[model samples]
Target: MEIKEVAYDHPDAVELSDQVQAEYRTRFGYDDTTPLRPSYFDPPRGLYLVAYENGAPVASGGWRAQDAEDEGYAYGDAEVKRMYVTPGARGQGLARRILAVLETSAREAGRIRMGLETGEALPEALALYTSSGYTPTTGFGVYRDNADSLFLAKPL
Candidate 1:
């Protein structure tokens, strides 16, 4: 597996984003509608990372700077987004690898915490974060007040 940093609109990255949304539609009954700008993932503020297996993108995730009061944000809250691993790549730790990369990159970029909003349907994602030190928190972001939403935070 190769972990590579890329622009959010990079061809491969865009492809994976679509794939993630497709899965999300099936799992959550709707696709995420939040606006995502490529610049949001640029360094000095945040980053986007993709993991490739045999040259095929398998997993991806990114974080962007957010004020403490902003949705999906808390202390050091660089809001995590688009975290996903392809079905064929499950159980290989690719999701965790991408997550660690996001956390480390965000910390190096001067962030002190990480936060995210996920839906209840994504047990795998919640499990990954919980086992990696993320603790339950209140909901924010597009899913705020949504009964099926789950929020988590971690100190970087």
Candidate 2:
């Protein structure tokens, strides 16, 4: 698999992003949730990555600078966003690869820590984060008080 930095407009990246958004909505009952946007995707605050196998996108993820206070803390950090792998691409470590890339990107950007919020319904995601060294954290960002959201963080 080839992991590459991709623009938000990249066709395969966009498609996988849509799949991730759909999964979030279906699993958490949200109407229009998404992991990437102009504010995060534009300028020097964010990064998007895609994993391709045989030229087909198999996994993707993004990260962006975020203020800890927004989620009920006071620290400078980066947030892991939009991590997903195609259903057929599971069991091959695609998600872990995407996460390693995103974390490296965040650290290179001078971020000392990373955080994220995922729904409780996503057992696979929870397991991945836990195994990857992300520990349970309090609500962060715009997800403060969201009952279904589980926050996790790790130091870079």
Best by TM-score: 1
Tell me how far the alpha carbon of residue 50 in candidate 1 is from the true structure, in angstroms, after superposition.
0.9
- Model 2 spans with C-alpha error above 4 angstroms: 31-35, 42-44, 71-73
Off by over 4 Å in 1: 68-72
In order of appearance, the predictions have TM-scores of 0.94, 0.89
Q: List lDDT for all candidates, in order.
A: 0.88, 0.81
Candidate 1 has a TM-score of 0.94
Clashes of 1: 0
Q: Positional deviation of 107 in candidate 1, in angstroms?
A: 1.0
